[model samples]
Target: MEQPLPKSWSIHTRPEVIAKYEILERVGSGAYSDVYRARRLSDNLIVALKEVHDYQSAFREIEALQMLHNCPNIVVLHEYFWREDEDAVLVLEFLRTDLAAVIRDAKKKEGGIRVGEIKRWMLQILCGVDACHRNMIVHRDLKPGNLLVSDDGVLKLADFGQARILMEPGFDGDDDNHQLPVEQNTGYQENVTPPLDVVADAHSLPDQGFNKQVVEDTNREEYLRQLVELKAKRHAVDETDKETNINDGYSSCLATGTISDIDDDPLKSSYSYDAEEGGDGRNGALTSCVGTRWFRAPELLYGSTDYGLEVDLWSLGCIFSELLTLEPLFPGISDIDQLGRIINVLGNLTEEVWPSCCKLPDYKTISFAKIENPTGLEACLPNKSADEISIVKRLVCYNPASRATTMELLNDKYFDEEPLPLPVTELHVPLTKNNHDEDSPGGWHDYDDMGSDSDFGDFGHFKVENTGSGFSMQFS
Candidate 1:
């Protein structure tokens, strides 16, 4: 029998290591991974090969892609190879450019991505998000840069490093349990069914022997009163429990100094000029301090840990608007500035708009200049048609619950209106331009020349082009 190859592939072995594949060039890099455009030796077909230094992130991404690859709108994972040095490599379908690059290319053209093209891309994006949500996954980091476009015009959602699995409602394991893998849980035993009581569904209703008609007629008013009281009690209890979990989670993160302790903490603290020392009191999986600065949702801005898929919808709204203007809708320099930019466009968040805003962790601490009667979307997105503006209005809503869902957005009349969504094949985005040179410091083969025993080597040669909105670069 033939011996199986090891998961940890050595990077030091140049052309001889993965003899079947050839490294074409270095394409992109992030805090954790380096991306390369490579060719499969067998077929000579190109692929985007991402070498992730973070083992857990690679594991999370592989798991997510295993479930998400079936969706046509999502990027397809071709193969996964492991490295013995705590690194992982993933092979994915190559695309011409990402939506951010497409947007930039459009700026140089006569008429940027047209209305039909924008609508088409937006629909495809929504389809991808729908796929993730259907699989109980959330793409916490949805941005133009992560949305890849092919030369033939298909838009595929990529980058799952920050993705997460959402636990079902009423699931009793630690609400923050999603953040920790099963192996990491205390006293975790294999093949042991969770304690029935702990996993019981909270929303499941109880049965009664009484007839339905008799009960409704007799207990209508009384039933409503009881229901109201029950809801109030449940809300109070849930809030208190969630608050405790948040505090405990943050305390644990602060103590251990683990990178995953705080959501959005790493990138924000290092990059943002005015980011707080420790993130804004977000704890566990609920508070995803992910998403880029300009595309960040309003709930995240207010430090709400209970946010859900609507947060992504808010980002879609921003991206959709950007497709029209070729600029970020809210170009805030810092978190405070970002909030101010939002308030300037959408107006202040009052009890009437989002009744739960005042309850957010940072609500009491951060104060904004009150602006009466905020400007409408039409004023900000004057170039967009009425239907386009309507969709934008629904996406960037104050209350997360009130935001339009993926399916709802799909069914909206805006899609049915004039300038119908273009077919994917008809869409046009500029071809990718490789700005980095092969001979550059961080270029391809930087590690190949090093001794084979060397685990890793850093040859930093990344180039940045100011997009005027903020620094925009491709991340793997």
Candidate 2:
């Protein structure tokens, strides 16, 4: 009798045997994954292979990929298969550098951004988010690192690592603990951290009698008590005896992959930095999952139970600002420093903004500093206008409930009257004369509209060029 293979083996493909999809180079890596540039054996098309260690995470990505196949703004997931070694490789469309690298490079060249480019990128991001919302998927993580720019300067949303797939037609993806937060308290309900999620659920639930009784009889006090107990229990493990006020577990998980010895003793880092190391359950990379400290949402940084895609949205807004300013909106050197940075840029959270943060899962440990101090986007991006700042404010609102929705963001005044340029027409990709063969593999610079002859890829050159419409690309 032959041994049976696991259900996951269904998607497996033997790369060694098939002689297709050869690895070109290692381009990217994550906490539990590595991404390589690959070419299709038959079609000779360049693609990206994201290899994952965890089977379930890979499965979840595949599930989401199938749902998002039709969305153009999202990175196209071509196929998924397992190597003979059982390592899963998700064949994705090949794209150029991510926004994080792009912005950093752009900043270094001219030391900042041109307003016109900022407008274009922000609209693109909004379109991407809107597409995700229409598909009923919430990207759990959205940051500069996850955003990739094609060689032609097309911005695409990628990395569905923390994405939540909403069931289409009549399907619901939240059955069992499939969609629950990794750090979700045992007795808690998996309500959406998004304003849309909270509102939709609020309306869906019954308001009278038995439901009322259930709500009343339920010890609101008890659930919080349990959360406190669990948080206490979690803290008690090693550092609990020391009683250091660390926050979420993302930084810690990151450390696990980065450093192993810290697991034993009380390692010393900045207070704010250590706060990030504390994992919020275990949602991010076991190592290097800290995408960007400045882009972290208030809920994740301050500790909120209802945190979810809303956090990602917040990061996107800040990223958009960073692209424009060529600087992080909130570059918190330490965890406490992050709070100050946020307040300085977005204004401090007020009762008028976030009234019930105290009830959140991370609330107890959250130090709600006085609203006496404040941060607003305009102050952070002194070069940006009120309208530009308005867009950021709506997305990065302290109260998750008040944050902007994908739909609302799409309809923002920023895009109210402008036309979004198409890929074939709007992009001005000057293909390198040396790599003119469409069939032959092109180097990174050859494909990039803004890239130079340099190996790292030329970045940050802005020149003003008027378009048919009022909107323009400042690339002179």
Candidate 3:
């Protein structure tokens, strides 16, 4: 029998990383990556090293973060390492805690979170999301856990494993004329060259700046060899080990690597909607199987493949609701239960509400009895003022078109009212807790045992009965 590789041989323990940074402790873990708190040996700067096992996710995250490097609300990528045949490692700014921890800490306090503090956090989240949306990127997974807070109370969007670029940066005019080929398996185009401006904007740590040489002479030689090979082929797409299906029980919220192999030549991918076919286009379809069950948008729950930035808006509403109430607004046990919960509150999704409702893949397959007098947002947020309720209402609605954009929400009058959003310096920053605590850095606790998949076993026989006030599921 072959001997198992030692823990020291792990990707995070690569010689290039171990030589330059002192590994402090493992901070977080997930399906595709492991995060560690490390200290740079040269300048003694603390940073998080993310070792990503999945190639495609690493590629997506690296490209997204690089594009949004100048955005204040998005997490900064200090640098990254991606040697051939090795896992990509990202060096990210060290954020002590996340929004989930802040929410958890608020729940323990007497009056819950302060109105001003809530506003500040919400503003930061909106800013980050707005930056992504404006850049034509959609962060498919936008839960509180992915919102990291620095020691100075600055909240930045962190995880981008499920993020997708809607279109090439400058080619936004006509979708019909410029239809880019997309990989059916990965939902991204293969071997597409990145724009010149994007290549020029790629940020990397300066060489020969800090203490001793960051890369040893021997390591530099190896790096140069890899760089030459990468340039020679123009970073050819590696289709091996690609995630073929989005619904393969892999969590989209998993942590991804810091650097990407295809960093220099970012993949150009886009989603196309065919009006005649209802949703999916001939070019390609964006996966609806993204995001956590609770925070997933209604269109995604109903299996709408042709989605856009609006999905993140729905998640933003869910996160804001949790911030206000310290409880998840919709904590459904399964995808079916999730949809049912939405119906129980928002009433049946109809053509009157969303003209494209019938286009959803599962709209006919999974039918629910009409909900009469559905519970309103006011009921869910009884203590919240009308203005607060209105904010949530704009986001959680069935009509994706009606959902408020990040820029619109940022300029809302809610922020102009008394008890205004606290300044970044004055905001209360929560203490970083161990993984065992409920408020782990990246919402680690929330990822465990998120119900079973048995509920989706027989979708053909799926039936949802309206139980007067709520919904109950039955199958035959």
- Order of candidate numbers by TM-score, starting with the best: 3, 1, 2
Which runs in model 1 stand beyond 4 Å of their true positions?
A: 1-17, 169-284, 433-476
Q: What is the C-alpha RMSD of each candidate to the true structure, in Å?
A: 14.0, 16.7, 14.0
- lDDT (C-alpha, whole model) for all candidates: 0.56, 0.48, 0.63
lDDT tens string, model 1, 1-476?
A: 99875544344353332675688766665456667778988899988777777655666676677676556777877776663443666778887577776776676689888877787777778767766755556666677767877787777778787566655311111222233241211122332232111111101111111112322343444534543443354345334545333421221001111122222111111111111211343333354345565677876666555555566778888888888887768765445556666887788877788766766655654556568767767888876677778888888878765677665565566665657666666677665533223454532112111111101112112234465444422111
Candidate 2, run of 10 with poorest lDDT? 262-271
The better candidate by lDDT, 1 or 3, is 3
Task: Give the true-structure RMSD of model 2.
Answer: 16.7
lDDT: worst 10-residue window of model 1:
196-205
Q: Best candidate, TM-score-wise?
A: 3
Error of 3 at 464 (Å): 10
Residue 228, candidate 3: Cα error in Å is: 44
Clashes of each: 4, 24, 1
Task: Output the better candidate (1/2) by TM-score.
Answer: 1
